[model samples]
Target: MISKLRFNTVVGKKVLMAVTGLAMVVFLIGHLIGNLQLLWSGAQFNGYAHFLTAQPVVILIELGLLAIFLLHIVDAVVLLQGNYAARPVPYHTKKWGRSKSKRSKKTWASTMMMWTGIAILLFVPFHVWHFKYHNPVASARPDSGQVSPVVVGVGSTGVNTSGAASAPSKEAYDLALQVTKEFKNPFVSGIYILAMILLGLHMYHAISSALTSVGANHPRYQTLIIWGGRIFTVVIAGGFLLIPALILSGLIDPAKTLATAQAANNQVAQVPMGVGK
Candidate 1:
C-alpha cells in the first residue's frame, strides 16, 4: 500500500515550495527595513539605498534573490498543474457537508493569497524593468512639467558638494525618487496602493504557512506564529504603502533624496588613492 501511494514522487515539489517561500519571506523583511529609512529624512533614505546597492555582498544577495524568485514561480506552476491533474473529476454537488464547508471558510488574507501571489509575480518584472533596467534620469522625468536637473552632492558626511552634475539617469536613487513622484497621478498611485495591500495579505498567509511547511507548528508555538505573521504583514505592507502616499502628499521629496545619494557617491569617488604615499 505504501509503495502504491507514490508519495516520494511529489515530495520534491513540496520541498521546493516550502524552501522558496521561506526565502522570500526573509527577503521581504530586509526590503521593508531598508524602505523604512525613508521616514528618517530624504538623506537617510538615499544613503541607505546607496549603501545597499554599493555592496558586493548585496549584489550577491540580489542574484540569489532572483534565483529564488524564479524557483518559486516554477514550483507554483508545477504544483498547480499537478493539483489540477489530480482533481480531474468535477464535484457534482454543492454540499461538502457542514464540517467540511466550515473548514473551507478562510480569512481574507488566506483566501486571497494565491491571487495576490499572481499579482506580485506579474508586478515584479515590470518593477525591475522600470527601475533597474531603465535610465534613471529618463525614468524620473516629470510626466507633465519641466524642472531643471538638480544635482545634489554629498559632503564628508552627507553634505552636498559643489559642481556635481545632475543626478544620473539610471541609479537606484533616481529610480526610487521617480517612483514616488510618479505616484502623484491619482490613478497610478491608487493601483500601487492596492498592490501593496495585496502584498500585505499575501505575507499574512505565506508567513504562517511557511512555518507549518517547515514543521515548526506546535500547540505552544502556533499562536506565536499567527501573531507574528499578522505583525510582519502589517509592518511590511504599511511601510511600503506609506511611501507612495507620502510622496503624493508632498511629505517626501524624491529629487532631494536622489541628490543626496549622488553627492555621497561623488564623495567616495573623490577620495584620493594612496594618500599616505
Candidate 2:
C-alpha cells in the first residue's frame, strides 16, 4: 500500500521515517564489522578503509545515506509538530498520559527520543571529521589499485615500500594510527562513549516505534518486536561503545605501533641490497 501512500498523510511520513531508521541500523552494523578490522592489523584495517574510501559505489552509498538521514530527521520534526498542533492547548503535556499507565508516560527513554536523536545527529559529524575525512594515516589509493601487492612510499609519503619506504605511505594514511590517537585522549573517548550511550537510548525507543510505524506490530508477535528492539540497540550501541573503550584503555595502541612500523621501514631501507640474500 505504501506504493499508494501519500506524503501528506501521517502514515506515509512515518513509514518513510521507519524505513530510513532501519536502513541506518543496517549501515551501522556493517560499518561496525568493517571497523573491527582495526583489531586485526594496521594494514588489514587501512586496506579496508582505502578500499571503501576510493570506491565510487561507496561514495554513492554515502550520499544516499545522507539523504535518508535528512529525510528521517525532517519527517520526525514534522510529525512531532503535527502532534503538538493537534493536542488541545491545556492537555498538551498534562493529559498525554490519560491513555496510558502513569509509568508508561513517565518512562524517560521513550519520551526522550527527540532529544536523543538530536544528540546522535550532532555526534555523527564530529565522528566523521575525527575518523574519516581528516584521517592522518589512511591510504586512499589502495582501492583504486594505484599500488600493487604492496605500496611503497613516494619520497616522504606513499602507501608502498619499494627502494625507500617513508612515512606510512603518504597516499594511504594509517587509520589505525589516527583513531588510536583520537581515542586515547580522554576528551575524545569520553564524548564518544557518551554519544554511544545516548545512541543506545535513542535506538531503544526509535526501533520499537519504527516497528510499529511500519505495521510490524501485532499482538501475537509484539513481544518479539520489543525484545528485538532491545537486542538491536544493545548489540549495535554496545559494539561501537567497546571500540573507544578499548582504545582509551590502551589496548588498541596503533600510534605506537605505527611508529614501530615506520622504524622497521627505515631499518629495511638501510639494509645492504644483498646482505639478507
Prediction 1 TM-score vs. true: 0.71
lDDT of 2 by residue, 25-57 (tens): 999989989877776665566667655654568
Instruction: Point out where model 2 deviates above 4 Å.
Output: 1-5, 92-106, 136-168, 255-259, 264-277
Query: What is the alpha-carbon lDDT of model 2 when measured against the actual structure?
Result: 0.70
In candidate 2, what residue range of length 10 has the lowest lDDT sum?
148-157
- Cα displacement (Å) at residue 262, model 2: 3.2
Give the clashing pairs for model 1: 135-169, 136-169, 136-170, 137-169, 153-263, 154-263, 155-159
TM-score of model number 2? 0.78
lDDT per residue (tens digit) for residues 140-246 in model 1: 22221333232121232432211123233311223344455567777767777888888888888888777777678888988788788889789888988997788
